[model samples]
Target: MLAIDETAAARAMIQISRVAKTYRTTDGEIPSLRPIDLSIADGEFVVVVGPSGCGKTTLLRMIAGLMPPSEGEIRVGDRIVTSPHSDVGIVFQSALLLPWRTVLANVMMPVEVKGLPREIYQPRAEALLKMAGLGGFETKHPWQLSGGMQQRVAICRALVHDPKILLMDEPFGALDAMTRERMNAELQRIQRETKKTALLITHSIPEAVFLADRIVVLSERPGAIAAIYTVDLPRPRQLDVLGMPEFVRLTTTIRAHFNAQLD
Candidate 1:
């Protein structure tokens, strides 16, 4: 059964209670996720990892309120997530920055959409870009930057609106291996500074092990929580942790689950 801590649920910023989904097709009903019960406390960083087709993205979309669960409910800050709310920010695999807009303008897009005063959010946006190491490139267009730089711009855009929760779906998946490592470090620093409650989904065991305060591993399709691990490794983690015994042990344990599937 899925684990639920009553105390954590009481203080959760995001709560998933018996939430599940099934897609109805002409042929039959196709289940995506099994009933899931999880809670993310305010300012906590949680990462979900699963095999291909395990509905990791489906789960994130449900929490974002982009889609609804066929069963149960999702609550954010004690409010039910029946529809997409401004309290959340999302980042996807690709940077998805508009080519025509300058980096600054792209980051300002959310403010524009909500018809908020640019004068007020301008300073905030600039601050976020600078934090992401995109300060000097504000005036440059998306096409002018390298892939990793563009993704940094995307991170800035996601945070510019000052959302309380960040939902990232493989935000670094498109970068080269070396660049992905660097972006992972950058993301950890940003998360620590912002203290925004975050949920990230990735296929990489190392990524999940490195960044998560707690890691949720999902079973293969018709996804359910296979295990949830609390990372005891030290905070402000660095690449050197990859060599540490605890790091290797955790990653190896998580990896073995997928390896078991092929047996």
Candidate 2:
């Protein structure tokens, strides 16, 4: 049996029980994820890392209630996730901001979708943008912002609705190395301040170690939980943490898993 951290399970805000996924195609059934279980504590930061086809995104989508699992169930704070609920916000690789909309407008998109009162959420959107360091760019369009800035806008948009949980899928994959590192720092800070439970999917080991409270590893296709490691490092971690013995050790251990798979 896959063991879950007892402390986390006891107070889990997100409980994924035996969740699995298989796609039915004209050719045949394609197994995307094997039976998997995980418990994410309220306000925790969990990062999932694995090979390209390891079903990491599939797990994320299921949690977001974007798709149903082939088997098992997922719950958020005692409520079963049958569909996309208001308590969750999602960020993707692309910013996906509307070209016609200004930065502030893009951030308010969730409010529009949910039919929330503009008077109530408009200020919240502006506040989130300001928190993301785009305070003066509220009137600017997506085309005018740098890649990192656009992603920051995306993050602000995801939070404007005040979701309790945040789900991100390879959010920094499109950035150059330096910018990606900086975004990692920014994301960590934002999560800290907002206190939202987060689950981010990424292929970068260093990124995973830097951002996660716990890191979950998945196997290749028909992905199963290969391992889960508690970060055990201090919070408000800086980039220099990458050079720390514990950080290097954790990243090396995670990297070794993939290397063994290739062997």
Name the candidate that leads on lDDT: 2
Give Cα-based local distance difference scores for all models: 0.92, 0.94
Which lDDT tens digits does candidate 2 get at residues 93-209? 999999999998999999999999999999888888888889999999999999999999999988989999999999999999999999999999999999999999999999999
Query: Which ten contiguous residues of candidate 2 have the minimum total lDDT?
Result: 1-10
Return the TM-score for each candidate structure.
0.97, 0.96
Give the poorly placed runs of model 1, Cα more than 4 Å off.
1-6
lDDT at 43, model 2: 96
Positional deviation of 77 in candidate 2, in angstroms?
Answer: 1.1
Per-residue C-alpha lDDT of model 1 across residues 1-263, encoded as one tens digit per residue: 23546667878999999999998999999999999999899999999999988889999999999999999999999799999988889999999999999999999999999998999999999999989988888899999999999988888888888999999999999888999989999999999999999999998899998999999999989999999999998989998898999999999999998898768
lDDT of candidate model 2 versus the reference = 0.94
- How many Å off is the CA of 203 in candidate 2? 0.5
